[model samples]
Target: MALRKLPTHFFPSLQHQLRPFSSLNLPTLEPSNDAELVSKMLLHHHNPFHAMESSLQLHGITLTPHLLHQTLLRLKHSTKIALALFNYSKSLPSPPLTSTSFHILIDLLAKVRQFDLAWQLIVEMDQLSLSPTPTTFFILIRRLISAGLTRQAIRAFDDIQGYTQTKTNSDDFCFLLDTLCKYGYVKVATEVFNKKRDGLLPDAKMFTVLIYGWCKIGRIDMGERFLNDMIGRGIEPNVVTYNVLLNGICRRASLHPEGRFERTIRNAEKVFDEMRERGIEPDVTSFSIVLHVYSRAHKPELSLDKLRLMKEKGICPSVATYTSVVKCLCSCGSIEDAEELLSEMVRNGVTPCAATYNCFFKEYRGRKDADSALKLYKKMKEEGLFVPSMHTYNILVGIFLKLNRFGIVKEIWDDMKESGVGPDLDSYTMLIHGLCEKQKWREACQFFVEMIEKGFLPQKITFETLYKGLIQSDMLRTWRRLKKKLDEESITFGSEFQNYHLKPYRR
Candidate 1:
């Protein structure tokens, strides 16, 4: 399908809204602002160009490279919309896009299954003597490494070794190390980093990516060690570096919460304070994370306190900052307070994403507040700003099932399909879990079968729970059907459901 050319009115509107970069001081404009504008523009549905034009003018916003980058970073997972903005911007008359834009977009094409288009973009870049730095080997390494093809990623890395720089000191080396680290190949990424580090000049961003890799895999100690090593080299760990470490501590605590949950929260707070001590004031990300830390520890007071401190310090709270506080409020069952904070977020000009509202759905589920959840869902549709996502429907269905509102579960399920939201892994997991809890073994088995039929490998735990439920079920026909399907899938109540994974195909 051809995307319509930019409407005639778009250019003057965008150009007028965005004063020439020089006049407005491009240096200070954060990409997140532009990215958010683009994100909201996506709500238009018909033409993203029109959506973007109207959104920018409606908000009287300007687009600068920095703001665009931040918004794209936030919308990285919203690839379709991001690419739409990317394409839409290519047709614009002001604030010309850069090769860096192409670099990240090229880096992301595989994620959106745009292999041929990715190549075509590369070819176009090559024609302009601006390849955005992707060799075929780069894409191969990313895809192969992502598939746990470490040997192949390495082999492909070797294929592009004809460049002038020595293998260890090249940008290719950094790319290889970074990609390796990104996919939980941290052990291997560490090996690659160490081998390259013997005489290689240190780069903080390179180290930051590795630190994030380790932290991503729940190895906070290794992340800390890297931080220490970076600091010892007379290199200052930037705010981003600290945020990575903060996330590491938060992840470690989340995974190993002893019900007390205090230890991790303390460690996270220590990191937050350490940032201040080092003259690296915690940014919005830092506050948001600590907010999450406080929330998880069930310290709603601490969460609220940090939120106020965020405002007092003049650190503008990002959507994440507000959402984390909202989540905490909802989790702590301060539903009224949560609603107020959400309102505050909007009044403060922070647009709520689908995730922010999902927090409320989760709370409604906890309290079996179906009417409230349904009311919110209706409002989300009517408001047209933040569309309910797959997570939304899954939460709604889960809420109904938990409340013993089975009829509404069917309604939500149909609505989900109608809206083209789910039946994804979480959807299956929630359904299976909900059905098992309700002892609705027959419907549970039905979804279990359909889940596998759709090529979603069932989580072993869910399979076990369902299989056990089926065995205990009085519905003999459904049990036999599920048993036959399980046989085909190599899943038994005892075995790891059909075995081999697959969090990133399950990473």
Candidate 2:
């Protein structure tokens, strides 16, 4: 859809208010005095153009570039008024507008979506031989890209090359390329890079950003091509460049079958080894990515080997590093080893995050070690290193429910509320199912109502469980009321519950 053009009448009233300035014999007030008087007038007048004209006539001052720039700054909040003020200043006989003033007005116009007027001003600047600064072009290009006008932004960038005085540097090219790539316009970004590459040499960080952008969109081949191109250009790849390629390879590996996955990992490891050979020492991020790859490939032993090597190299394992290894250990049923690693992490002053604790929680639950799971939960709260996520509460609720510990289940529910963790679908499901199983109909009904009010639609199993308990407890009135509410919500009990007959009750 086309953007609606700004209304013409938006400025007519202000334009009429400034018309009387033509008749006044304005004097050449000092620039400082003119700025001071205009600033005062701006505070009282609703229309900035009106304030500027009134100040000029009263002080008998002409709008010099310095004075006009000051007035533009004062009126920067309203684009329409600023544009009117700029146009009106150009019509004055003394103290004409300068390139600096034009730059400010054009930027203001672009900001307010008045691109047509801004382009006109740029053309005017060119005709007057007023060369735009590099900063001016940079701001214009960035704003254009942000407004989803990539084509216009590219055109504006091309215009910059025509100016002999304004030299576009590496930073200027990188800024536009980065913005374009970030917004999923990689092809456009490539065009920009190609346009400026001969003049502005691409640095390592620039190559890294482009490679990362390609990797992000799952085009690993393009990323590799860029890496090779960088190498061919005699630009040595840095640690970040290799890491981006490694991450891309690992991510692609994850999507493939076992045979292809192994091949991908081998390719990634080659890059890793090559980086080390080149004396670009691996950082914590490099190690983390390798460990994650091994974890995904289901090679816990290899992950352990990497951890040992990481420690040997004096690179400390981060929370992510430990978490990756812990997850690998748990997945392969090496729960004891995982626990020892967790203990080692604590001994080394590294606090295990919520995810780290949750990893152990799942393993203990799977092994039917209820006591151990409860101990871990207590430790999580006691340490207060991290708040338990909703998943944490759901696990505890499920474990206590299976153990038939009703009081503990309620306590966990209260804890979830106190910690500001809103119960999700599974949380409500477990609570409702557990309460109904224990024949606590009143409490079950309260939670059921609360769940619906919070916009959670109970599954068919939830309806069946609640219906069975209500009928068994002979709460015919409560069952009928619940039925009416469900009917109002357009939800019907599944056919599986059709066999059960309910006693009729008066409304």
Candidate 3:
């Protein structure tokens, strides 16, 4: 919610400096929930402490029980503000807050490792005669897991029946699996599934999450085994299940692009084929994945065949689909063919992103054809195909810097800032590294200072390389000044780093 006046409801960290949103229509959000309404007033209009008193009076809308819950959930990500609002709400002369309300506040407290306070409130809910819902335990379990209290999360789940009146259902089982899998606790989630597998009959979703969890940790073989188990036990795998395995297979295959790649690719194809055999038609995501694998294999023909098959199947190829085929064509030196596909994609109304254009730029970059690369970049900007993202700028700057084109690098750097793409750590690193290579120690020092002030920690190698240049130029005063700044910022530069004066640049 970066939009103005309506509120930065999503990102509390980025809530400041509400930019003018002249292009936006405020009335369009007319039915925007009370959550956004109060959130806007609280965050944008008044101070956090006196917000409910002033802004709610000003807004003149009542905070109903449902609205309060929604607002709490909306601000759940911002624990401090949410806790303040909850505490404030408790003092209000409205209906007594429910067990569910206490659950959210407990969640906020638990996130900050204030588990003692959270449990006290949980006990207090019982005192208030509020019956605990399964969500009471779910909230505790989820937040406990997030806090890396894995055993505690499981304990909370086990204590669910003892606390909450509601019996755990399939939804609860799947929810726990989903939550655990989300945090890369696949093994633990599996253990819970096995222990609780007595009376409860599981579904495809239960198995899918386990597959997803296994896939997330790069265990493609384990994911494959789950798929086999599902099929053998008369549990049917859907498009989502197949898609997950295919993604895992493609990812593994991409990494092992040596002798193992072909075998891995064959496995992906088998899962893909199994989908069609089971009457599960591949969605755009499935097709795009297959296209990506073909791109990695550098099979331009196979990539085009897949693209052709997609159109034949009446499935629209996405920007990702075109980008994959472009990568394949570019890899095999079919620049003309890739360009033709890009045009085809545009004609089909799927706008090319930075990645789609980056493929062409990369081809020219590899050939050291700076003129052709810049030409394509210029054409894209002028034609309004897409704005070059920070990543695009980073790549363009690297290309210029590699060829020692400092003048062009400076121009691109200025343009990048002008485009409102603030230089991040990677951008600063690229510019500082490039400057060091050119013996522009002064510029490197300035940018390095800016980088540090912006809370970016430079790599030890980069720091040493830049400092070595300063020392060689007899700039000990400059070194002392920078060293003082580092001390104030509580950043350490050990004696070994300062002793870069003795050794030449390692490279």
> Taking the tens digit of each residue's C-alpha lDDT, what string does model 2 give over 226-324?
999999989999877787777777754553577876787678779878998989876777777778777777788889999999999999998878988
For model 3, how does the per-residue alpha-carbon lDDT over 1-507 read when each residue is reduced to its tens digit? 011111111111111111111111111112345667675455444443343553344334666666666666555434445555666666667743776678767775665445666777788777778866677777777767765678988888777788776678887878788777767788998898898878689788888878877886789789889989988989988877877777767754553546666786678778878888889887887778777877887888888988899999999988778898998899889999998998899899998888888888888889998999888877776877787887789889889988988888888887775454546556887888888888888888988876554334555666677777788888868877876666654412233134323244423
TM-score list, all predictions: 0.60, 0.47, 0.60
> What are the Cα lDDT values of the candidates?
0.64, 0.69, 0.70
Q: Write the per-residue lDDT of candidate 1 for residues 128-160, one digit (tens) a residue.
A: 555333354475467567657687577656544
Q: What is the C-alpha RMSD of each candidate to the true structure, in Å?
A: 13.1, 19.6, 11.3
Ranking by TM-score: 3, 1, 2
Q: What range of 10 consecutive residues in model 3 has the weakest lDDT sum?
A: 1-10
Model 3: pairs clashing at backbone N, Cα or C within 3 Å = none
Model 1 TM-score is 0.60
TM-score of 3: 0.60
lDDT value, residue 238 of candidate 1: 81
